[model samples]
Target chain A: MDLFEYQGKEQLRKFEVPVPEGRVATTADEAAEAARGLGGRVVVKAQVQVGGRGKAGGIKLASSPDEAKDVAGQILGMDIKGHTVKRVLVERAGDIVSEYYVAFLLDRSERNYLGMMSAKGGVDIEEVAETDPDAIARVHIDPLLGISDFHARKLVFGAGIEPRARKGAIAMIPKLYNAFVGLDASLVEVNPLILTGDDRVVALDAKVTLDESAEYRHPTFAELKSAHEVPEQERLAKEKGLNFIKLDGDVGIIGNGAGLVMSTLDVVKAAGGEPANFLDVGGGAGAELLSNALEVITSDKGVKAVLVNIFGGITRCDLVAEGIIDAFDRLNMQVPVVVRLDGTNAEQGRKMLQEAPNERLIPAETMLGAAEKAVELAHGGGA
Target chain B: MSILIGTDTKLVVQGLTGREGSFHGKRNRDYGTDLVAGVTPGKSGEDVDGVPIFDTVAEAVAETGANTSMVFVPPRFGADAILESADAGIEVIIAITENIPAMDMARTVNYIRTRGNGTSLIGPNCPGVISPGKANVGIIPGEICEPGPVGLVSRSGTLTYQIVHELTQRGIGQSTCVGIGGDPIPGSNFIDILEKFEADPDTDMVALVGEIGGDAEERAAEFVKEKMTKPVVAYIAGVTAPPGKRMGHAGAIISGSKGTAEAKMEALGAAGIRVGRNPTEVAEIVQELRG
Candidate 1:
């Protein structure tokens, strides 16, 4: 569950981390007004989960209210890294004496929480790791001991913060760590964890990715979920309790099992077309889920074609095929659906699909062939 | 002849008073496993499918002398079940519950590692270990399995069955098949099971099933490259999976530019592990490797 920049900043503020005063604005006038409230020097940052927003002109500096309005106008309708800028975070620009990156993630091999802090934090951590590997400092936290003052101090010092700011960095570490565990975050990142000219440490930017598995414990957080920010198809899928995440491509996919769905995605890419969404119906998913899934994919205006890949085990392939046929009938879907069904009763499923009256329901012999057919149909081929 | 369960393996069911427990427990008993006793806290002297339910795993182990356990406890209480069974000196334990919290798993896995006292755990979300024609444990569909020499290890439960069914269709019977569960932190890893397959003379070749998360497959590939003399055929699922969206299991999320199907496949390929494109290909690859 990726939080918008404004939401992440709000979480940081709760932990007493100094973030620039900001307000989210949906319109240019609102952004201009927010900039005026911030005394005119502000930054307009497009709110999207994807990175490289700065390079894509999603981040703009405004020296005056009018400039803020102009910047917002330019950004509001612009596409940044394939995501449209629907909302912009208008924040009072701060002085950055230095920038650093800090994040926490689970290290499976170590079987503990991993704390990574880098002197070079403003850019992608991947770039930092690839180019200047020595710039990043990695620390493993023992679950038993948890994060301690000493550990925090060592990490801060190791990240190469100046001696003068080391104490403040140490002070901020525990606060960030507390927010991470308290908020059930899979990733709590402060990219460009800034040092202001006033000798104050502030989180200039926040990118938090929460763990949905811990949703049962955080009811308030569940309410804070921003489905409006997600793509239209995925938002609808979520409402129906279907697991869906929209991608950038045109081929829509629905499958059972995480592994199978992913493998299906690869097959699509291998077949010379990009996938538009990854939808998993899960094991033991019945007609209702299947119907919702197909509706979710076919409803996508960007989807040129659809693919259903199932390796039925406990859930029978024949039942899934029945659901697909029923969904096609109920919705009167016009788009092409290429299905690749295997495992128990798969042959029966293929026969059922083949006998279906709809010409759009094409059954493929294998995953690769299914992907190829989906790609072909997506390119406006087939009956 | 199997790594975990076989004819000599005496097994008991945990949370046997529950419906799922009784159901799978009955299946294990009917499959001719040495289903000796059961454990359900404060359910002592109760009978579940004619299996005596004890108050705790210690009592069950003491009475039945069962050295192996198949756990069907709910997610919340799963950690305690594993600890209890481990404390009872069980040789092998398999947990079949899904969605055990990360924090709970971290603590439980750490404890199991430190205090396992030579005990081995198969899963917290997996279909338990099965030795065809000998014993059955966990929730794997038994109809797909037949006693033979090929070994199978997987993360996805249903996919494991699909691969096994395909294998069975091709007259390829399994030696010992284990599901390591899809959770990020599983009890047993690929290396743990691979070592068993490597050492078992009955096992001719191993079929490895992986998914689009973590470096588990890469590690397994490393294991196959450096140590194993027998052939390894690997298939990583979820190539079409969207980045960063975890639908099936919490631990199955793609994070930090790693754990992609492409990455896992490339790693496995570099290690000389024959990568199967689909479930049906797994058996064919293993067959080629066996020769």
Candidate 2:
């Protein structure tokens, strides 16, 4: 789960990583109040998951409480990169001497933790990587050994951090690593880790992505999820225990595994249709789960047609067929559903669907054919 | 001559008493795998479908000579299960448990790699290896596969079945199908399995099913270009997946400009591998290469 800037700062503070004092405000009045409490020039940053907040005018500087309210009001309802800003973080403005970047993230390729640091910060690291690759220093830290003093020093030195800030960067790097591992975060990025005028190092911005799998250990993480942060469809899907991602398209997709579902999405696109959503019923899905998935997909009024693709390994196709029939009956589904069943009682499942007497339930032999049929139906063509 | 498992594979299942464990255990055994033992601590001496159960992997290895271990333990104990199997000197460990903490996997994978014990770990969220008609380990449905010269590796479970089904339908069969799991840090990667496939005598060409996320496919493309002599057909999913959103799999997300299907396909195509636009096209490519 991606944490908002304020939440990320709060988490960083717990690890004793110095961050600019900030207060989360949901309303413009509350933001003004927060700025007043801080009693100085403040920056009101729109709390959204996406980047480019500053470029999108979702972030603004306020010299006084009234200006803070006006800026927060402007940002609160702003949509940057499709994410509506619902909250703003009012933080006391810092006197920056130099900007730098530091992060600890899971290096998927290496299957280890990776620490990255750069003297150049407050910008997209990817841009820095492309333009001056050597400016960014990367180190792979062994999970067993963790970030040692030497390892921290290597990043600090390799990034060519100024000698004046070396000790502070070195001391701060390990704390960030602690927050990364201790919080079960997949990524802990501190952009514009500023060297203040007083020579103190502080994280000016935080982008922390926690591993949802490790949420079992961190029960308090539930509080981090604000209800409005999740879309209605996603919230409903989560409640149903189905893995669903909402997308803007016409054809709804439901499949057995993640790969197959993603492949199905690609296939749908190849067949000249956009996928409405990515829904994985997961392994060993039964009739009830399938019905629930169908209900969730159909709930999206944008979905004109649905594609049910299952290559059952642990999941039986017969059960999936039953679920389709069950969902059609339960939801009174009006959308055309092109169903493709393969592996694990596929024949029986096909026979059941064929006999189900629903004109909307169209069974196809191959995944490609099913996608094409779904696409055609979604475009108001006859199947 | 399969790459990972064959008739010689003496399989032991961890968490055998669990629903998924016991179910797949019986199915694998029924597929004619040498299902010798199961490990469920405190459930020692118990048996799942007549396969002996031991309290620990050490005991299971010692008594049954189980060389290959299939793990179906919960996410919390998944790392421990893999570590236990590796410490007990198991040659091949395939973990089918999903949602194992990334930190736990990192530590476990690091230990296994640094230990240099020749113990190959396949997955922590994968469907295991299947040598068609020889042995089935993990949860790949044995019915869809047929013994042939084609080697298969995938980052998915059911998608692997779909491709294998396509192969079987075309009268083209597989020597071994390895599902490396769809986690960010799979124990075995595309290159690892591809290397084995290149070395295997029975395997002629390969079909690789990759999705978005990580540099695994890009790296595999480099490996194929540099080392492998055999033909490789590849298909990558999530071409339409939007950035910043995970497409079902934990590892199947397009992060920044990296790990995009377009980039992966380009890399593989540039490496001289036949990159399929879709799964059926992947099968067609393999069939054409076979002919």
Candidate 3:
């Protein structure tokens, strides 16, 4: 789960990492009040998960409370890369001598934690990686040993940090590492870890992605989930305990596993229909879960047809078939559903589906055939 | 003739008294795997359908000479379960527990690697290993698989079943099918299984099932190009997956410009491996290669 900039900063502060004192505001009046509290000079940053916020004109420097209010008003409703600005971070403006980048993330290939630092910061790191690879210094930290003083020194020296800011950077790296591990974060990036004129190292921008599976340990993270920030379908899916992602298309897909759901989406696309969403009913889909899934799918007005693809292993196809029939009895589903049952007890499941009274339920022999049928139905062809 | 498990695999199950553990354990035994013993702390001497349970892995291994372990513990104690098995010197550990914290896996994986016991760990969220008609270690349905020359490896459970069903329909059987799980940090990778397949005498061509996430597929392609002599056909899912969304699997997400199906397919295709646009196409390529 990605954290908004204000939340990330709050997390950083909890770990003793220095960040500019900031206040989160939803309205222009709140922004003005926050700016006044910060001595009348502030930076109004649009709080969105996506990047390139500054380029999208969602960030601005305010010289006074009035300017802060004006800037916050302009940014609150602006869209940056499809994410609407719902809130703004009003932070005290800083005088930066130089900009640097520092981050700690799971290096999936190495199966270890990776620390990256660069003397050059604030611009796109990937572009820097493409243009000047040597500017970024990467170190793989052992998950067992964690980040030591030696690792921090290596990163500082390798990145060629200026002598004036070396101590501050060195002191700050380990704190960030603590936040990364302590918070169960997949990524903790402080881009433009700025060197203030007074020689203090402060994180200007925080990008933290927490591991959702580790949410069991961090109960406080639940408070950070702003309901307004989530889309309605996604919020509903979460409430129903379904793993779902809303997509743009006509055919709604429901499958057993992540890979199978993704493959279903692709197959639907290949058969000339776009998928409306990716929904995984998980390993065991009972009657109640199936009905809940159908209700969620039909909630989207764009979904013209539904595809239920199940290759049961732990998930019994016969049980799934019963659930689908049960769902038809409970919900007033308008869309035609193309169901493909395979793996465990698939024959019996298909037989049950064939015998069901619902005329809108269509059973196909193969995954490809089922996808084609769903595509045809979605495109207004005969069921 | 299988790469991971065969008739020689003496199996022990962890968390054997639990719901998933008992179910899959009994199914595996019914499929003719040599179910020697089970380990459920405090439930020692108990039996799940005549399979005796030991309190710890060491006792189970000592009594039954169980060399392979199937883990069905919950997410919280999953790392401890794997560590216990490794400590007991289990030669092969296939973990079927999903949602194990990545940090826990990281530490467990590191500890296992640093120990250098040559213990092969397959998954923390996978559908075990099956050597058709020989031995079933984890939860891969033994019925769909037929013993043949083809080796299969995938990052999914049900998707693996889909591809295997396609192969069975086409009369293209498998020597072994391994699901390496869809977590960000699985114990075994495509290259690990592919190298084993390359060395195995019974296996002929290989079918790789990958999805959007990490650079595992891209790295596997490089490994195939450099080392393997076996023919490989690939199918990468999530071609239509949008960016910044987790597609069911925790690891299956498009992060920035990396971990896209298009990129993985390109890498695999560039390595002389036939890239399938869909699962059926993958089976067709495997059939053609086998012929």
Best candidate (score: lDDT): 2
Candidates ranked by lDDT: 2, 3, 1
DockQ of each: 0.49, 0.88, 0.83
If the candidates were sorted by their DockQ against the true structure, best first, what order would they fall in? 2, 3, 1
**Cα deviation of B196, candidate 1, in Å:** 2.6
Q: Write the per-residue lDDT of candidate 1 for residues A29-113, one digit (tens) a residue.
A: 9999999999958999998878889989999999999999999999997887667878999999988898888888766766678
What ranges in model 2 sit over 4 Å off? none
What TM-score against the true fold does each predicted structure earn? 0.88, 0.98, 0.98
Winner of 1 and 2 under TM-score: 2
Name the candidate, 2 or 3, with the larger TM-score value: 2
Q: After TM-score superposition, what is the CA distance of residue A122 in candidate 2 from its true location, in Å?
A: 0.7
Q: Is candidate 2 or candidate 3 better by DockQ?
A: 2
DockQ of 2: 0.88
The CAPRI category of model 1 is: acceptable
| Cand 1, B chain, TM | 0.97
True contacts kept of each: 0.47, 0.88, 0.80
Cα lDDT, model 3, residue A80: 93
| TM-score-sorted candidate list, best first | 2, 3, 1
Error of 2 at A358 (Å): 1.5
